[model samples]
Target: MTPETSDNRTLPWFARPAARTWRCPPAPAAVRDFHASLPDYAPTPLIELPVIADELGVGRLFVKDESSRLGLPAFKALGVSWAVHRVLAERPESGDGAAPGPVTLVTATDGNHGRAVARTARRLGLRAHVFVAEGVHPRASAAIAAERAEVTLVAGSYDMAVRRAAEAAAAPGVVLVQDTAWPGYERIPGRIVEGYSTLCAEIDEQLAAADAGPPGLVAVPVGVGSLAQAVVTHCRSRAAGPSASALLSVEPRAASCVLDSLLHGEPVSVTTGETTMAGLNCGTPSSLAWPHLRDGLDAAVAVTDADSDRAAADLTALGLSPGPCGAASLAGVRAALGGEGADGRRATLGLGPDSTVVLLSTEGSEANPVRVTGT
Candidate 1:
């Protein structure tokens, strides 16, 4: 199926009067400590883009580059490593100081998350089983396999892959470490979402070191809304200050489940299609993530593949190698800050000339490459 194109005059956007109140616990210090203990672990770069900021009419622009996070090409390692460690740590060890039996980590992914799960399994001497949808790229599947994981290709969408992975995880010694959550399967997914707080924590310190105050606006690309949930949790908390930092979510127009859900006032599944932004091609919002998103998001926007491609090209010209998923944040910012009725939209979003902005560039080109025009 082909992706949908947004109206050049106006992009799809939803806004609320005041963000609903949602109490989210701050990320524990242990999460950061655990991530720091990993091999090659370090905080990713928070690059300041003065040129882009001027173009976007914002005071400052920063992109938290997650391209080379912990030796992975994407930010999934932050969540996967912590969740896997927590799960394993909570397991009952036999008196012999060993697990009772062999354990296998299982999950479904469009790309980066699966590879992350496989890497964790390989590091811990456990097995990994990764299920991918039919549309997943060959390089993604191969990457998972390269990590010594047993890769299964599900003949459907990412949602179907998740179902198949869940079924497989029903067996003994197999744990489903999926990032998305459904009823009766909330615990591990919650842990996965909490694990993402490490990224937010890093962003805080990086921004502080640069002498930048809290961002006035933060854009995050959403896929099943896990990372968005983490962003909302960090940005909306009292400790982050009651600063009016509007959280914006970006999704592929063809797979905008989060936007659809927000419009409907409930979590609703949509029909997803192939897109260059493979990592954000989810058809449903995670059940566990929906509440926080519903309450915490200031706005949601959907961008077409063309929009993301252009944004990617622009970032590349500026010496930033962002994948389609990563560039989606910039696409969303343009949609929100430009176009018809943009003045009113900007006013509502509290965006102004001196507003600080941060775009979460969640992946690098190696995760999902796309040919951008003029690049």
Candidate 2:
């Protein structure tokens, strides 16, 4: 079906045939093992919201609460820690007897990813230089600085900040550890995406423990699509069988790069605007992630900031402290399963009253304060 568009945004929902031909190597078992080796490592909660399931008309709803992974308010630590560890471990040894100077990790962020990179650097006795876009909350930049990393405020959008970070990383002894990937810059981002598999692995075990069968739908919030890439890779792996879970990509309506790209059948850069879901306010899809998302995603939806705010409030009322980005899964799900032609859309995506759903609440309230505008 052709997607209806207005104001350069695709309408609330779009679905396509789930691709079975896209194959990927299983994420290494060592990724989870490495995370388990971390001092703060523990499986985050897989919270069941039966009330929400009843409301949304699904059998069961589980939210993978990544609010406090590794002591960070967001799940980004899983990827950043593993990626930094791999990069440092693979660094070539000094040829001469002289010792090497301290390595400085550099990257761009809207909020959480930069802090994760900075925290990794601090733990390794290295330096970090984080670049952030203009209008980033002072508190977000301050949080990165609290890690002892030097923070630079770029006078442009997140994409511009990414470019600036790349330029700085060109200098000797600096490494760019961005989660988003372009053509020649995919290896590290691939590792970052691999690191995110730890979250999915935990979800599998947790679902078993809860006696919940395989998920029928898995909803993820996309920034540059790294996390969604990881989710698609994990859910579409050979082990998930032919009846793999349907994947949904959610993004801020004003910055719905992945949704726009999926609708356009290509990687399309968007002109993003400010949104309460700041972490997902990305303009471009990661080149490494685009192909996986293109083939593996079963649906894509974009939510307004107001939609996310209400979802956040609802999650809070349900006793979960999800930030706007984290709460966006609910918004997307609501959009897809409610409103006009809901029955047809649900049928297209194979949703039913008995279908189990999993939402990746990728961050906590500490990352971004939720502002519910209604009484």
Candidate 3:
């Protein structure tokens, strides 16, 4: 595929820092404390990529690998498990703060989040009801069912499933644990964003242990922008550098809600339909996260299906079996660093030879099996 030229591009947004402090509302310390208490909780690897770093002409490239977080194939467990705990832990009949009741957790997903919610519900002796769009990845659907949750297939896209799940959550004892936020429904999605902060915290500690400073830039795959919010919150609040890290929000070209919203200066629904990167297939930015992302991010990049598919193969060669969604950040890096507007974007965003870059490899190769081989 030819490189996307600026004249014909629907990609890349270079942002100026907001006049206000670029911070999200603080997450509860209890979420992090709860995640730490889990037996399976462990920090995923922060792999240094000398080869890609050299090619990208950067000082260093570090990937926060999230393929195996809390025994799940993707990083969704960090948010899902923590949100589940926060919801249950607040209940009066939490059984001496040990056993939760026969509640049901409901949510919609392209794949990983639903499975994570289901697994988290099971761990707490609660039932789960997961909703997915009709065309979700087959393996993801099967995996959600494997967690013993009742899976309902919706007729349209991920957003439609989200609406359906919201409808289903009206039943008594059923709680909607969604990642995207809407009007009057910001609390749980806010908690979900908070849960994701654990990864950013772990990345900070790991970098410090290696005597490395904070990365100059962080490129994250944006679905509804929850993970990006976490990264921004951590980097802004505790950055060792004089300034916050330059944030690049990456999304599927077909479903560039964050990019579209930023351009319009408000939330706008994207109608390009789904792309291959299922997890990043969101059509609208989360209400809770749009403010942080709109002000704090340095740029936004949209990559094509081919771009992410190729990135998945390249990451696999580097010993990380990233699925298409996971590798979108890498693809964004390529597009941002090598395309026609590369020099302009770099200079505009403060990325130079002295810069260190971090990419969030969000999941393993579960969404695309044909292009992936080994673990």
Candidate 4:
């Protein structure tokens, strides 16, 4: 129950399709208002990555560096803050408003999301009760605690912690603010997904400033499928070339829920396996995110263990120290490009040099290296 010392995570927010923006227009008006009220929050820059471009033979490769976004080193804060904010704004009758006070926001985390929730809750004068599956990364756990959240490690897996969070949220007054959505509990997570559109909006503005347009492709890491859909929807919404943007949802080969879901056109749980990419180890896709992805995403791919580690190392080379799960988008790109035993996966996905690609280094490697080296 100790605090997470540093947690001000990042996110790819405000992605919309050409027709409209707002993933959940029906979402709490206050949530929409909060997004509309960000005067001080500027868009993150889209850094052109020569190294990645040259390797993939792409004309250009861009990175939306979440690590640098708001300096939280991960994209979790966007969802956490938005979700908590919505929950508090909804329960106006409660004393102390959105402040955590006696009631706490609860959720499970394999990595950044818990820390994000904690960070947001603390900032709003609220408390967070974070549940982590057994063996959650020590640094990730430390980060959550650093935010002054109560970190609870359950005996089972991330799913188990999620179950506990749901149960806790069911009680009166306490809120279960989570990123992954389940049945009848779609609004909060959907708001989190909506928050990611801001990332897309920023990328568009940055590209406009450079006198260029949107990228041809955007690779997204799929945790519960929210991020992938969020980014894809935003990038494609704009009027653009023939194939506006192609999304490649990357998952751990072992725990490839979105991949399996895409392949089957229905959600399914893959048995969990050992992988260093804890955040990307989700076994199922969010039903809320499923439809958007099924209709919009171009393809889905699972990355190998070597791909994950090599990507971590490669990101370090990119001057972006990314945690295993965070660097997964770049890792999958490298694999698809045949850079790391992925000669066919790239061609199979129809990727080539002419394409402009964007990757989100979702986290910083303050912990992944130590975990990887230990293994």
Model 3 error, position 278 (Å): 0.5
Candidate 2 has a TM-score of 0.95
- Segments of candidate 2 deviating more than 4 angstroms: 4-10, 97-100, 239-242, 370-375
lDDT of 3 at 314: 88
lDDT of 3: 0.82
Residue runs of model 1 more than 4 Å from their true location after superposition: 1-10, 20-22, 94-98, 239-242, 370-375
- Give lDDT: candidate 1, residue 175: 97
Give one digit per residue, the lDDT tens place, for model 1 in 126-237: 9999998777778778889999999998888889999999999999999999999998998888888888999999988999999998888999999999999999888777
Candidate 2 vs 4: which has more lDDT: 2
lDDT for model 2, please.
0.88
TM-score (C-alpha, index-matched) for candidate 3: 0.92
Ranking by TM-score: 2, 1, 3, 4
Candidate 2 lDDT over residue span 1-375, tens digit each: 466443455465667775644667778889999999999899999999999999999999999998998989999999999998899878877888455657899999988999999999999899999998776778888899999999998888889999999999999899999999999999999999999999999999999998997898999999999999999899777544346788888999889999888878899999998788989989999999999999888888998988899999999999999999999999888887877666777776778899999999999999865322210
Report the number of clashing residue pairs per model: 0, 0, 0, 29
Q: After superposing candidate 4, which stretches have Cα over 4 Å from the reference?
A: 1-42, 92-102, 339-352, 367-375
In order, candidate lDDTs are 0.87, 0.88, 0.82, 0.69
lDDT for residue 44 in candidate 3, whole number 0-100: 97
Best model number under TM-score: 2
- Is candidate 2 or 4 superior in TM-score? 2
Residue-by-residue lDDT tens digits, candidate 4, 165-284: 888777765788878887898988888977777676667777777665667677888888888767756655554444556667788877888777766657888877777888776777
Q: Candidate 3 lDDT, tens digit per residue, 21-55?
A: 45544556676777899999988999988888888
